[model samples]
Target: MTSGPECPLLFLDVDGPLIPFGSSSGHPQDSASDTWTSADQGNPLLTRLDPELGPRLIALGCQLVWATTWMEEANEVVSPRIGLPRLPVVEWPASSTAEGPRGLHWKTRAIVEWADDRPFIWVDDEISAIDRLWVDASHPGPSLLHRVDPGKGITDADFSAFDDWLRLVIPR
Candidate 1:
């Protein structure tokens, strides 16, 4: 598989983007999918996943990587439920060191480092102004830091934004 500078990387977070969690039980009407597999029985939250999202994400044509705390487990559990194949997982740095700026999320630095000059899109609910500013200052390639609503997960609007940015940044 061609990685490195050839393809744009999409760093996906599981807690919010994949599994929609709200005060009540329901998910976004449009984003919900009926696809469910036997593998999802282990985790109750897994039921919230819209299985069809896997195909949509694959259609984006970016190299998908797991950026969630779930780590390798993302491949083990989430992938099967969503109909995605095993994806690369980001190896987080040891947390014993100092934390950065006040608003900066812990994963921002690692995400940028993993990209290593390759263009990337980071989809997570925790992104803030501080993360954006840091990536702009530190990363050398085009980047899009998109924040999904934890309560709603990914919506049509988010996919549209991703598609629009990708069209401009990478050619088919």
Candidate 2:
């Protein structure tokens, strides 16, 4: 098994996916005015991640990266709190629509620029088939992109889904 957070890199989006985008009562702010509507705005989130999950992803030879609108926000704030290994920083692109605050094109572009021979999993709520197609076509090595609903939170169901994919892709 891999001993470092350098292979099977897992590109994580700090806002919507890792720290489910919501509040204390899980009040989902799906309104047009809720751009910064993540609990990450409230308190530290990753401190709450199940200890088992981090180790498991690492055991699978996965690395965690902050791939959100936060950009280097993780490097400044999230990483030290979560104790996640500091990986490369990714910035959002300049072509994102500024109407409602979602800038997925930027994320996609980041993925494209950051592509390498290492296998990766892009876990974000806004990714689509176009995203999957974009990376699969443009990047090197086998790729998996999972669109996790922030409303559901990263429950056991989430990990189970990831586990299924990992089992199929990772060699014994």
Candidate 3:
């Protein structure tokens, strides 16, 4: 099978989706159930990353792209720790001009622009109704703007939703 725009893109955000915060149990913050990596780089939160997530994400069969402020650093630090190979990074344009309607997240427009008519799933904690509306109006392809809970990060439920969507849209 050849990969193309039909192969959905999964735009991943590090802060909220991967390194969840504010949760009391089963989250990376628990420390007891989490594993620490030697490549901390003085950022303790890096230790909270669940290495298994990489395989889980890869299994989804989407082209994973780093869509966070971490940028290239995500490839260098986050990828290895999470057992993910280097993936594409979404570089935000060097300006503050992509303001959609009032409640949209700053990254909304850029994410849509990056997708460029390709089906994509944008996973971020800050998504809002405006962003969804904006994407629905602007992006001309199947898209899932999933908003993960910053407190819990990505859960099995999230993966289930992704699986359901992928099977329906990309069909493996």
Off by over 4 Å in 1: 1-4, 23-42, 96-99
| Residue 104, model 1: Cα distance from true site in angstroms | 1.0
TM-score pick, better of 1 and 2: 1
Clashing residue pairs in candidate 2 are: none
Best by TM-score: 3
Better of 1 and 2 by lDDT: 1
lDDT of each: 0.85, 0.62, 0.84
Clashing residue pairs for model 3: none
**Model 2 local distance difference test score:** 0.62
Q: How many clashing pairs per prediction, in order?
A: 0, 0, 0
Give one digit per residue, the lDDT tens place, for model 3 in 1-172: 2347678999999998999886545644333324434445577666568878999999888899999999988888888777799999998878756655877778988888898988999999998888899999999999999999988889999999999988888765
lDDT of 2 by residue, 108-141 (tens): 7667567566677888888877677767777877
lDDT score, candidate 3, position 7: 84
Cα lDDT of model 1 by residue, 1-172, tens digit: 2455668999999998888786435542223334544454446677677777899999998999999999998897789767899999999988824477777888999999999999999999989999999999999999999999999888899999999989988876
Q: Pick the candidate with the highest lDDT.
A: 1
TM-score of 1: 0.87
